[model samples]
Target chain A: MLAAARDAFAERGFEGASIRGIATAAGVDPALVHHYFGTKDQLFLAAVQAPADPEELLPEVLAGGPEELGRNLLGMFLRVWDGPARAGGLALVRSAVGSEWTAKLLREFLVARVLRRVVGTLGYSPAERDARGALVGSQLIGLVMTRYVLKLEPIASASRESLVEAYAPTLQRYLTGDVVLPG
Target chain B: MLAAARDAFAERGFEGASIRGIATAAGVDPALVHHYFGTKDQLFLAAVQAPADPEELLPEVLAGGPEELGRNLLGMFLRVWDGPARAGGLALVRSAVGSEWTAKLLREFLVARVLRRVVGTLGYSPAERDARGALVGSQLIGLVMTRYVLKLEPIASASRESLVEAYAPTLQRYLTGDVVLPG
Candidate 1:
């Protein structure tokens, strides 16, 4: 069922994929899907086997002071990528890259559950918050692509501590520093 | 020849695609492929219809002072993406994402022709140079993915001038600022 869901999502994207279609592909009754997964979003979360549960992990990352938020965020990111959850994260990224549905699902999940929450604490204007969130997203997504997927040298080989130190400052700037956005 | 080469490169990647193979695919003699393209590398450059000639554009980007290097790099990047070259750039990126051969080709091209040149201009240790180059690569690649390929909101809608202002400082930091990488 999960596999079918993944295929459907990858092929059709979020808006186009249907629970009934997934159930039919899985050779299971539609009621079984609803019974097991509750909803399409929930099924996606399960199929992706998300590397981290943002609801559970975000508080731990957010507990520190604003200055250390970048460090904490990156630290958690590295942990998710480097630790036992690495496979799941890699799978999600591969699927996201291959499918617009997966990309949209992942993007919405990150924005609503993670980035928005972090930006909410910072108290910027809506536009500023959106800009900052996107900037932060760019850095994180780039880091993942170059370091993990493409396996670019130096970065792919760098120690966890080195990456955290090098990236945290940039994240800090995006999170709270002065970023000029033209009107 | 170019269309066949593009399809071959996009499907099989650089290492896998051969002059003879391209010729066969195009229903031409292998000698004709050599006659026109001279070499695989030359053929790739022609097929991708690369937006900026690195040799010509790199000097212009690197001529400015270090403080403005990030801005110049991004300015050139945005110009390449926003101008008539947009189609070529988009095709290259899409092919790169679809095939490891294309990714490797793109990576080597960027590193050898562009990033290394920029890093070489700055007198850093070999290790530091590699690290800094990768950092810059991450930001630029991420920006392209979000702004162009995925069409992420806010970033996709941002004006060229606004993106330049917002991203230049981060690029500057990655290029010349103090990036600590533990030994």
Candidate 2:
């Protein structure tokens, strides 16, 4: 089922891949798939070995509210990557870089499972919200790649709060500042 | 020689790895290596399959002087990734993500061959300069990873100028703004 789910997600993305279709590909009943994973997002998480759970994480991460959204999001990201989620997160990143299929799955997971939910709470127009999400994604991806994968100096060794304090403003701007929207 | 260059670089990094050592590993004279590759930078470029040449690029990239540095740099980056350098750039990124050695080599190249020279022209404390470089690296890595590798929407499809206009601030801020220096 997991393999089938991965194949489905990789081939069709989150919006295109359906629970029923995934079940059919896996040779399992649709009810069993739902019973096993709860929702499409949950199943996608299982398929990709999700680094963190958005459902459980989004509220806690956002509890600091709008002003601290950037700090909280960045801090939460630092924690997730620093802990046990490190290995799985590394694996997903590694796989994504090499394979287009895996990259799409990773994209679907980030956009559908994570960024959209985080950006949804903001009262911006849909277009503004999406551009914000992409900006946020770019910074996070660069930070993670350098600190964890490349282990770039000072950045890799910097304390989490220190990084959060130093860098959170960049995120804050992207999330809530008067950023230029796409034409 | 290229394989030997890769090994030496991956193990000892750009500064640490010498032509003599690479040549020794390849069972050739140091002069022969230098004769063929010209300089250590060129050798490293061939070894890693550099997406673009810094020597050729830095002058034009930084020609806008300090005021327009961010815009010029980002514009240059978008052009490089959107052109023939795209495949080699993608290959290097993919390999780096999966291998620690490759990641180290990448860090060394970015720091020694590119960032240091770019930052050196400005008069600042070494620590301040280093921090700025790291911050710039974080954003550029993120942009390339998403725009080219992951193909994150709007970002991937965004008009080059729109992206440059939207993103140059982040880079400019990191480069010239009063960024918080590490203690």
Candidate 3:
């Protein structure tokens, strides 16, 4: 069922990959899928083995002073990518890069689960918040692609501490600094 | 020859795709490829319609004071991406994401043509230079992926000026700011 879910998500994306379709692909009843995983979202979360639970993790990272949020956030990201869950994280990125469906799934997951929660804590206008979140997303996503998936040198070889130091300030700027947005 | 080069690049990557192979695929003599394009690298530049001649453009971008370098770099990037050359840029990024071969190709191009030249202008140690180059590559590549390929919101809709304002500082930081490197 999980394999079916992954294939379905890879091929059809989140909106197109229905529970019934997944069940059919798995040669199981839709009820079986429901029994195993309460909902499609749950099923996806389970199948992707999402590297970290944003709800559980973001609070801890965001607990520090706002200025420290960027460092803390990057620290958390590095840990997740370097931890035992690295395989799952890598798979998710590879899949996301491969198909629009997976990209949308990953985007929805990041924006809804992660970015919004982080940005929502800061009292910015909706436009500002959205722009900031997207900026942060671009930085982190690029970091992971070069460091892990593409394994670009220097980044792949740099110590976690170095990355944290080098990137935290940039992330910091995205999180709280003044940015010019479309008026 | 150009189509064959594109397909070969997409399928086999920079390292694996041979001039002989591309020539065979194109049903042309290998000498013809060498005569027309000069080298595989030149062939790729031709096939992808690379945004600008890095040698010519990078000097212009890097010409000003260091503080202004980030804005100039990003401004140039946006022009290449938002201008008539956008399709080629988008195709190169898509191909890079889809295959490791292309990723390596793109990486080499960025590192050799763009990042190294920019970083080389700064008087950092080789290790520091490599690290900074990789860091800048991550941000720019990520920007293109989200903005052009994935079409992530806010970023997708963002004005070129807005993005330049939002991201140039981050790039500036990577280029010349104090980043703690691994000892």
Taken over the whole model, the C-alpha lDDT of each candidate is 0.79, 0.86, 0.81
Identify the runs in model 2 with alpha carbons over 4 angstroms from their true place. Answer: none
Q: Candidate 1, after superposition: displacement of residue A167 in Å?
A: 0.9
Q: Which ten residues in a row have the lowest lDDT in candidate 3 chain B?
A: B47-56
Candidate 2 residue A120 C-alpha distance from true site, Å: 0.9
Q: Give DockQ: model 1.
A: 0.40
Candidate 1 structure quality by residue, lDDT tens digits, A1-183: 998987876567655779999999999999999999997868877866777776677888889978899999998888778888877777776666666767766776566556788877888888888778888888888888787766678888788888899889889988988887533
Comparing 1 and 2 on TM-score, the stronger one = 2
lDDT of 2 by residue, B1-183 (tens): 999999988888787899988999999999999899999989999988887898798999788898898999898888988999888888888888887778877888888877777776778778888778888888999999878888887798989989898888888888888777433
Docking class of 1: acceptable
Alpha carbon lDDT at B66, candidate 3: 81
- The per-model DockQ list reads 0.40, 0.66, 0.45
Q: What lDDT score goes with residue A25 in model 3? A: 94
Deviation in angstroms for A56 in model 2?
0.8
| Each model's iRMS | 2.2, 1.5, 2.1
Off by over 4 Å in 3: A1-34, A39-44, A47-49, B1-34, B39-52
Query: CA lDDT of B177 in candidate 1?
Result: 89
Q: How do all models score by TM-score?
A: 0.78, 0.95, 0.79
Which CAPRI level is candidate 2?
medium
- State the displacement of the C-alpha of residue A90, model 1, in Å, after optimal TM-score superposition: 3.0
Recovered native contacts, candidate 1: 0.49
TM-score of chain A of 3: 0.77
Best by DockQ: 2
